[model samples]
Target: MTSEVMIQSKFTKRFSKALMSLTLLSSLFSSTVHAHFQEIIPSSDIVESAEQRSLTLDLTFTHPMELGPVMDMAQPKVLDVITPEGRASLLGNLSLSSQSGEAKRYQASYQIKKPGDHIFYIEPAPYWEPSEGVMIVHHTKVVVDALNGKANWDALVGAPVEIEPLTRPYGLWTGNLFQGIVKKHGKPVPFAEVEVEWRNDGSVTVPFESYITQVFKADANGVFSYVMPKAGWWGFAALVEADEKMKNPEGNLVPVEEGGLIWVRTRDMK
Candidate 1:
């Protein structure tokens, strides 16, 4: 063969080999990416009591990664409740709120009125790929008591509730700086609103301009805490605004006087 033809043949062989190597690398990378995308963690379920006699539903999702900033807002999770009669009730209409950091959790609550056995479940959807086929639904049974009466004024009031401070010594604001729990009638009231106000020394109380208020929902065990800001003599009170649409176990709207105040004091600020 001519030297010129030999050199051309060698160059062609080298070029073909390089192209094949690049193709193989691309395929391997595509497969790795696909595998990562397919991985998904299972979800969790929670059942809560909205009132002494009513039940609330909570559902949470576990994702493989941080779920990207955009999808974080979407908070894709499906929730449903099966009535005692075996009727499937869709939970999509309920308001969904999420908190994400070290852990991501979604919460929604609906009042269950009838005194019977009800099933709550988390249905799987396409936001995150589930390892199991179609994600088996996980659920819990909740019981409502028919004899419980509407929440009383004393049972809905709170006192001496210490809240966590907002600003740390380093001037960093931790999201849930509040850290204290309030209870009424020996049961933890989750997601109840607490208001704080600074009062003058005189019997006549002047509300401080820098008042703090927060709405906190209790955990599954009906417990919560809030950080108290710079501590001093401050009037604190716990209140749960009555929901006219919500009926107590006795089928009556929970009642509380509007603008009601349950006074207590926080002495030491830490």
Candidate 2:
């Protein structure tokens, strides 16, 4: 073959190989499933002194482990704090957080006046996840201990689906085994599926895509447990399909992924 023809043939071969590699990488990444987590993280899980009485909560919808491609969060339909006293709406306190990208997030400030455990919860607007072909609704909550009063840490916020913490949900060190029962409509859901993820604050490097979200299931009576290996925020989401389907943006019926999420923090023993 002529030199020019030979060179052209070699270049074509190299180009074909590169194209194939790109296609393979794209397919591999597309197959990896990223778990969605609704975060309602508080500034302090426990308030001991007068200086710590005021607390701030950050609300966002995103892949907590992957950290991004944050989904836009609309104004929540309901935001409340439940305590032994009663449920009080905090929707008015929520304000838009200044974040990059078009996706919106929220924040709220609350003063811990009384001494008790306060469960702050949110019923976010349904998010349409086209990749999953479903609308996602995650009702998420976090507990804050006020003035050293730790009573009723397991109080339910009356979410559609909820996790009643078997553990205290706060004041813990790393490697602590956190346990909770998944409930739907105030009843235990036998053998429910739960996805857990650590809120990546750019500290821990994820080894693999699968490591981003840990998957496990609840046994009979819908109880689940996990020992957090890192000192940071961890979210447990128990997901179940609702009995009724909802219309998608295209006016087609799609399944609703109803999730009950709870957030807890672990600190390194000093």
Candidate 3:
């Protein structure tokens, strides 16, 4: 080959490699942002019989829309249950079980003895998100109705950040509108950003990548609403910065992204 042709070929190769690297980074960042959801899914959302008393919870940090790239979840900082009776610690019940290869997941099985609501909440270990240049702590929760429970789903679970459900939060049909108020420090966080997504069961195919996670903001009253588009589990996460800063693995103090997450399930009334 001619010297000029060889030079052009080398430059083309270098440019292609650089472009590929940039594309990968962009894709990774996009996936990382939407995957911040902290999931505490249960085996059942409604307990109706003595034979099905034990409720098993699946704990993980993942992108519900994509359903892959499951992030590693360390031991949770907070895991408890809130019932009409009162709040009690369920952290002792979480066993470090492996759901998939090398992905650390926590699972807890609780037997429902009462005929009310059981709210399972978790404050996961702060995850360091290098792409966003910050740490993320998603205080997540899910409610299970026991024998047609009451509307006690609006209780303040005392998370650093939380979502107080305005909807019934349980026993909902698809296409129902679910609403909640974002709260931090027991007060309203108006105009907060809430990211919404559904747990994909591999049957969904989004027309565009951006459609994987939907982002919306709460109103001035700290209230946000979303309609269930399909029959499955839906998650809402409201993000706010913590007043305090924590040191990352590199020993530099960084701001913490506090995400208040709530998971609710809907079904088609077939």
- Give all TM-scores, in the order shown: 0.26, 0.89, 0.93
Predicted structure 2, TM vs. truth: 0.89
User: Whose TM-score is higher: candidate 1's or candidate 2's?
Assistant: 2
Ranking by TM-score: 3, 2, 1
Candidate 2 global CA lDDT score = 0.91
Q: Which stretches of candidate 1 lie over 4 Å from their true place?
A: 1-51, 63-78, 99-105, 129-270
lDDT by residue (tens digit), candidate 1, 1-270:
999999999999999999999998886654323211111111211223444443344333321122212222233343444444444544554445454453344455555565433334343232322221121111112122223323111221122221221221111132324333445444456665554443323333324312222234555444444554433222233444332333333454444311112122233324
How would you encode candidate 2's per-residue C-alpha lDDT over 1-270 as one tens digit per residue? 999999999999999999999998886555348888999999999899999999999999998887776788999999999877788999889999955667899999998878889999999999988767889999999999888774988888888899999999989899999999999999999999999999999987888777888999999999999999999999999999998999988999999999999999999998
- TM-score: model 1 vs. ground truth: 0.26
Summarize candidate 3's per-residue lDDT along 1-270 as a digit string, tens digits. 999999999999999999999999988778566657899999999888888889899998888888867789889988999999988888888897784577888899798878888899998999988777789899999989887756577787899899999998888999999999999998889899999999989889988977988998999989999998999999999999999998998998999999999999999988
lDDT of each: 0.35, 0.91, 0.89
* Candidate 2 Cα misplacement greater than 4 A, ranges: 1-32, 99-101
